[model samples]
Target: MKTSLRILIVGQNGQVSQALQRRLAGMGELIVLGSSQLDLAQPDLIRAPIEALRPNLIINAAAHTAVDQAEGEPQRAFAINATAPGILAQVAVDLGAALIHYSTDYVFDGRKPEPYTEDDTPNPLSVYGRSKLAGEDAIRQAGGQHLILRTSWVYSTEGRNFLLTMQRLLQEKPQLRVVADQVGAPTWASTIADSTALLIERWQRGQPGAWGTYHLTAQGETSWFGFAQAIGESLVRQHKPCAMLEAIPSSAYPTPAPRPLNSRLDCSRLLREWGVSQPDWRSALQQCLAGQA
Candidate 1:
C-alpha cells in the first residue's frame, strides 16, 4: 500500500476482473491483461509479463470456468486453473508480492446437509473442481502471502453467468423448468471486488488477517429455482414479459458434470478474520439489476 503500489490482475473482461478493475481503479497502478496478452495455458510465457511488471500484488482472476465442458478436456482445464496458479504463486513468492486467487464451491461434493465450512474436506465432483482444488493446494505449497477465496454461484450483468442466462430465457420463453435440488448463494462479482479492495486497505494499514483460504460469498442460501424466481420477479416488476417458472428435481435436467446438492459455504471465517461481510444474495441481486438498469 505504497503511494505507487503496482497491482497485476491476470484477467480482463472476466466477471471478477472487470469488477476489480472498477473498484481498485484509484487504489494503485493496475496492469490488467486478457488471454492474448497473458495466456495461462502457456505456463512458460506467464513469467515474462509478470516479472516485467514487477507488481506489488498479483490478483489472478483468470481460469477455465466452463464446468461441463471441462469434462471433455481435463488437461486444458488443469493447465489454466491449476498449473498456472502454482506458477503465479511461485513467481509472487519470488517477487515478495502477495497473491490473491479466486476459487469455486465446486471443490465440494455438496453431500453435506449444512453449509460447508473451511474445515470441510474437498471432494470434487468434476474436472473443473479438481483443477481448482489443485490450484489452491499449489498456492498453499508455495508458502507465500496468499488469499484463496472460495465463492459460489457468481453472477454479473457483464459476464456469461446464471443471472444473464435466466433473464434472457425468462423473457423469451413462456415457461421454464428450473432445478431446485442444487443450492448455493448467488454472489455478485462486485461484492468480491469491493471486499478485496477493503482487504488491501487493511493489509496496507497494518491490520491484516491470516494468509490462507477463506469462504467469501454472499450471506444466505437458495436453490437455483429460488434464484430464478427472484430474477423473474424483478422482470415482472419492470413490466416485462416473464416466464412461468416450474420447480423440478435435478434428475429432470441432467448435464455432463454433476452438481452438488448443497453448495452453501459458511462465510463466518471470512467475517471473523477479515472483518468483511457481504450483503444478502437477494439484496446483491437487486443492486446488480439496478446497476444494469
Candidate 2:
C-alpha cells in the first residue's frame, strides 16, 4: 500500500510546514524548500524548481502572514501571497500534479453572525486578507485539482504565534490584556498537517473528488481572551508561571490592519465530505503545551 508519491512542500520553517514535514516524512519522497531556495516574493522564480521536481503533489504552505506589516507593504504582500500562488498553480497544472494551498479566515468581513461557509461571499477587510483571497481565486482559475484549506488563529509550540507569545508574556508580566471581541478557533499546526495527511491518504485510496475548498480548524470558537486563559491554565497544570488574563475589546488594542471579529468557520464540509474531525481548541491547546514541555 506504499504509494511512494513524490510530494513537494513549498515551505520549510513555517509552523504548518514544519508539522507537515514531520507528518509526511515516511509517506512520500518529501522535498521541502525554504525562502532561500524558493522565494515566494518573486513569482517568476517558482516555475523552474517545480518543473524540475515534477512532483505528484505540490503543497504551497508558504504565505505572507504579517497582517499589520502587510498594511505598510501591500506590494510585497501581494507578490508573495497572491502572485506566487498563481504561478505555482499553473506549474502544477502543466506538470499534471495535484496542489494543496492554505488560506485564512480573513477573507470574511466578520459581518455574518454565524460561521462562514464555503458558499458565503468573501468580503476581505485588510490587504493581507484580500491578497490571500486572490491567491485562492488564482489557484481555481488555473484549472488544476487543488484544495484551498482556510483556517484561523494558527499556532504551534515552535513558532512566532499567539501561544508562544502568551507563554513568554505570562512569565514576564503579572497580568495580560487580550482581545475579547475577536473570536475564532486557535488551530494547532499539527492538527492541520495530520488532517491533511488523512485526506491525502483517502485520495490515494480513490477519493479524488475531495479536491476543493474546505474550512479546517479546531471544533470550537473562543476569543483571544479565552485562548489566553486556556494557555494559562495549561501552564499552571505543568507547574509553569500563569498570568492573570483580562478581557479587552479590539478597540483597546488597535493595530495597523483590521481583524475580523468573527473568524469561526463552518467545518461541516470537511467532516461530511472527508469524514475528518478536529479536536476542540481547548483540548488542542493542552496537547500542544504538553509537547512544548
Model 2 TM-score, all chains together: 0.98
In every candidate, how many clashes are there?
0, 0
What does candidate 1's lDDT look like per residue over 114-171, in tens digits?
9999899999999999999999999999988999999999999997999999999999
User: Which runs in model 2 stand beyond 4 Å of their true positions?
Assistant: none
Pairs of residues clashing in candidate 1: none
lDDT of 1 at 231: 97
Model 2, global lDDT: 0.92
Cα deviation of 230 in candidate 1 (Å)?
0.4
lDDT of 1: 0.95
TM-score of each: 0.99, 0.98
What would the per-residue lDDT of candidate 2 be over residues 1-293, giving only the tens digit for each residue? 35769999998899999999999988889999999999999888889988998899999999999999999999999999999999998998999898999999999999899999999999999999999999999999997789999999999988799988988998889889999999899999999999999988888888754678999999999999988888887778878878788899999999999999999999999999888889998888878877777
The C-alpha stretches of model 1 lying farther than 4 A from their native spots are: none
The models' CA-based lDDT, in order, is: 0.95, 0.92
